[model samples]
Target: MSIQIGQALPDLDVDVVEDGAPARRMSTASLLGQGRVVLFAVPGAFTPTCSDHHLPGYVQHFEAFRELGVGVVGMAVNDVYVMQAWAAVQQVPPGMKLLADGNGGFARALGLEFDGTAYGMGLRARRFALYAEDGVVRQLHVEAPGEFRVSTAEAVLQALKAPEAGTTG
Candidate 1:
C-alpha cells in the first residue's frame, strides 16, 4: 500500500543535486524530517508534462510555498546528473531541491512505482505530491494515469490553506 496520512516518510537515502553536481547524500528523514514540506514526484525528468507544466508550476510558486514555511522539493527516478541538468535548465530556485532517485528505490518504497517498459522508459515514479509536517504525511495526491489535476501546485496550495485539509486524493 502507498504511504498514508500520519505515517512518517521512509528514511531512505536520496541524492540532492545542485549546481550540476551531486551536493550530498542524505536520508529522507533528515532532509524532510524537521519541517513542513511539499514533495512532488515526476514520472521522469525532461518528459513532456513534467518539463512543461509540473516543474514550472512549482518553480513559479516556489516563493509562495516558502512564504508558508514549507520547503518545496522535486524528485524523479533519474540519476543525479540528469536531475542537475534539469534543475539548471529550469532555473530552479536556490531553496528548492531536486532529488535523484536513480534506482527507483524511493518510489518503490512508497508503493508509487510504475512500470513504463511499454513506453520504453523502464521503471518510474507516478505523478504525485505529498504534504508532510515534521516527517509525517498530512496529505497525498497521486494523479490518475495520464491525467493531471489534483497534484498541481495550485491544488496543493489550496489544500494547505483550507481549514480542514487532511484528506488525501
Candidate 2:
C-alpha cells in the first residue's frame, strides 16, 4: 500500500552520504528517528527543475528548517556515487542530507515510483516531499504529475510553524 499521513515509514535501507564519513547504508527509521525530518524526492538528480529550483529552494532554506528542529533529506533514485557528485555540484548546505535509492526500492515501497522509460530513465521517483517525526508521516505533499508546489522547503517551514504542528508529535 502507498504510504499515508499518520503511517509509519517503511524501514527501507537507503544509502546515505554524510560529511566527514564514508557512505553508509542505513534504514529510514533510524534516520528519521533522530528527529523530525523533511524528506524530498526528485525525479532525477541533475534535471532542470531539480537543479535550478528544487534543490536551490531547499539550500536557501536549510538553516530555517534546522532552526525549526527539522532535518532535511533530499532523496533520489540515483546511485550513491552520483548523489555525492550532484551534492558537490549543487554545493548542498550543511543542514541537508542526500540519500540514494538507486534501485527504486524506497520509492516503490512508498508507491511513488513511476516509469521513466519514455524519458530514457528506467524508473524514477515522482516529485514529492514529506514530513516525518520518528518515522511517522505527519504532513505529506505529493506533487501532481509534473507540478511543483507544496513540496518546497518554504512550504514545509510554513507547515511546521502552524498552530497544530505541535500536536503532530
Candidate 3:
C-alpha cells in the first residue's frame, strides 16, 4: 500500500538550495515540525508539465497556501544543482522551498517513487501533493501516470477545506 494520511512522515534527509547557493540539509521531521507544510513531488525538474503547469501553479498560488497557514516545498528526484537551476529558470517565488531528493531517498521513504526508465526519465518520483500539519499528513493527492488532474495548487487548497482537513484517514 501507499503512504497513508495521519501518519507522521518518515524521517528522511533531503538537500535544498537556499539563497542562490547549494546549502542546507533537512529532514522530513524538521520541515514538518517547523509548521504546517505542503510537500509536493514531481517526476523531474524542468519537465514539460512540471515547468509549464504543475510547479508554476504552485508558485502562482503560493500565497493562498500561506494564508491557510501552510509552508510549501517542491521535491524532485534530481540533485540540488538541477533543482536550483530549474527554480532560477522558472523564477520560483520565495514562498516555496525547492528540495532535491537525490538518489530517490525521500520518495522511496514515502513509497512514492516510480520507474520511468522506459520513458528515459529513469527512476523518479510521481506527481503528488501532500498536506501536513505539524508533522502529520492531512491530505495526499497522487496523480495518474500521465495525468495532472490532482496535486495542483487548487486541489491542495481545496483539500485543506475538506471535512477531514489534515488527517490521513
Instruction: Give TM per candidate.
Output: 0.96, 0.92, 0.92
lDDT of 2 by residue, 1-169 (tens): 5688888888878999767356799998888765789989999999999988998899899898888888999999999998988888888876568989999999998888899999899999888888888888888778888888778777778878882542221
How close to the true structure is residue 83 of candidate 3, measured as C-alpha lDDT?
Answer: 89
Leading candidate by lDDT: 1
User: Model 2 — TM-score against the truth?
Assistant: 0.92
Candidate 1 per-residue C-alpha lDDT over 1-169 given as tens digits, one digit per residue, 9 for 90 to 100: 8888889899999999755555689999988899999999999999999999999999999999999999998999999888988999999988899989999999999998999999999999999999999999989889989988888999899989982766555
* Residue 10 lDDT (model 1): 92
lDDT of each: 0.90, 0.84, 0.83
> Local error of candidate 1 at 124, Å?
0.6
Worst 10 residues of 2 by lDDT: 160-169
Q: Which residue segments of model 1 deviate by more than 4 Å?
A: 19-21
State which candidate, 1 or 3, has the greater lDDT.
Answer: 1
Best by TM-score: 1
CA displacement after TM-score superposition, residue 99 of candidate 1 (Å) = 0.7
Q: What is the lDDT of residue 167 in candidate 3?
A: 31
Q: In lDDT terms, how accurate is model 3?
A: 0.83
Question: For model 2, what is the alpha-carbon lDDT of residue 154?
Answer: 77
Tally clashing residue pairs in candidate 1. 0
Question: Cα RMSD to native, each candidate?
Answer: 1.3, 2.9, 2.1
